[model samples]
Target: MFLVGLTGGIATGKSTVSCMVKDMGVPVVDADLIARQIVEPGRRAWKKIREVFGDEVFLDSGEIDRPKLGAIVFSDIEKRRALNKITHPDIYSEIRGQVFKHFLRGEQFVVLDLPLLYESNRVSSYLYKTIVVSCDDELQLERLLERNQFTEKEAIARIEAQMPLDRKCQLADIIIENSGSIAETRKQVEGIIKLLRSSNHHIYNRVFYGGIFIVVLTAIAMLMYWIFMR
Candidate 1:
């Protein structure tokens, strides 16, 4: 099975595309979901975060106050890096496991929904293809404001914190322009799905592994024949 990496800037409709893919019965290993799971109340990542950021970032219910933590990290590069350092390893480990499960299930391809696919840059090398979902900056800003209820300054800061959408598009094997209507976006996603389904990566991998298995079996038979002759 081959792996596809799906990414986009904040509020660029990556999640929307991800949901579309999921609805189509494609396996998607979502890193954002894994990140949240890893940091749940008493998880190792949660413990590390509480240790580093202190009790202030936790709510009265002992859950991490995401907004409070986000406010802290988004403004400070070092703190952001520290947070990533604490959580990333766990997140990646879980993502890898999920991908492996899909592979064992003999999926044709799996999509990894990673918000930081470009920024992290670690998993891209393993992906058969990378897709970037993007919109115009104005539309992106407008969406962020509406969805997150953030002031213009806060929305812009959040947008500026990640790798630029243009740079991500430049790196992508496919670009889904989400600035248009939902139907237009769905059409783009369907086209991408068809393209990925038609790919020869999975076929090539099966052929390659089958050849290796045959070679190993032949070598074993030859060794057994030699032993019998002796």
Candidate 2:
């Protein structure tokens, strides 16, 4: 199986590209969606967040008020780190399980759509390719403000919190310039999908085997340590 990572800045049309990919019959495991799911009221992440952030972050219905939580975490670096520390492990575990399921099923390809893929450094040791969707900076700010109704300060803070778009563009294996019409963006996505379908999967196979070897070796090392110490 081939795994591809899709990422972009907030409100940068990453979801749009992801949707286009899904429409092509490819499986997409969206990190954002998984994040939301893992934080549902009764979930461990939600419980921990409420314990840390307290009742202020929750609504009357007991759901986590995302805007309230965002306002808190986005403005405070330490708080953001704390939040990530609590949630990232579970989110990554779920994503890994989903990807492995597809891999074991012999899927031709799968997409992991993550907004913070670069920030989290989720590229290497997995993923055959990465695509960063981007638009004009001014346009991105406008879209964010309109979509979230955030003040300029709030919007800018959120955007700045992640790795800069230019840096991600430099690092990405492919760039989907989404500064134009939806049709244009869709066309670009189609072209990329076509290429991926035709591309060789040897690199992906090597990564999988390498990962398995590492896991097996680690288990053997642990067993040896236990035997010697005991």
Candidate 3:
């Protein structure tokens, strides 16, 4: 099965692209969803987190208080790393398990939607192709502030915690520029899905998508050559 890794920084429209990809019939496994599941009440990850961070991070209803915890962890790199140490392995295992299930169930293509693909150092090892949904900083900041009701400072802090978009774009195999309208973004995703439905994830597929204009001209050349020879 072809596995495509999808990732981006906070509020960069990665989820939007994932939705579009899902609409195109490609199966998607969300690492963020799995991470949240692993840390829900009664889960081992939840127990470990509570044991380390105490009940202070939980609500009276017994659920994790994400914003409270984020306030703590995001302010300190050590605490952030500590939280990562607790959650990352469990999150990774669940993501891998789900991806394997999809493969076993005979999916032609599967997408691994991750928020920290590069930060976790899993991109080069697990997937040959990574799609980074990128938008301008202004757009990203605007979206984050609007969606989360966060102040600009608060949104900037969250955005800065992740790898910079420039670095992510450099590391990615392909990028879907999301600064434009939703229709524009969906158009890009649609084109990508149509191209991927046919084959495995290899260097050839990479070149086909990455060098699309050149590949198109080459295809036309080959077609003309065949017609003339005939």
Find the candidate with the highest lDDT and give its number: 1
Rank list by lDDT: 1, 2, 3
Task: For model 2, give the 10-residue run with minimal summed lDDT.
Answer: 118-127
TM-score of each: 0.91, 0.89, 0.85
Give lDDT per model, in order.
Answer: 0.94, 0.92, 0.86
Residue by residue across 1-230, what tens digits does model 3's lDDT show? 66788999899999989988888778898987888888989988899999999999999887899999998888888999999999998888887788779866766678899899888886457575789999999989999989999878889889999999999999888899999999999989988887777555544544565598688899999999999998
Which is better, 2 or 3, measured by TM-score?
Answer: 2
TM-score of model number 2: 0.89
* Pairs with steric clashes in candidate 3: none
Order candidates by TM-score, high to low: 1, 2, 3
Which one wins by lDDT: 1 or 2? 1
Tens digits of per-residue lDDT for model 1 on 124-217?
8888999999999999999999999988988988999999999999999999999999999999999999988988899888788779989999
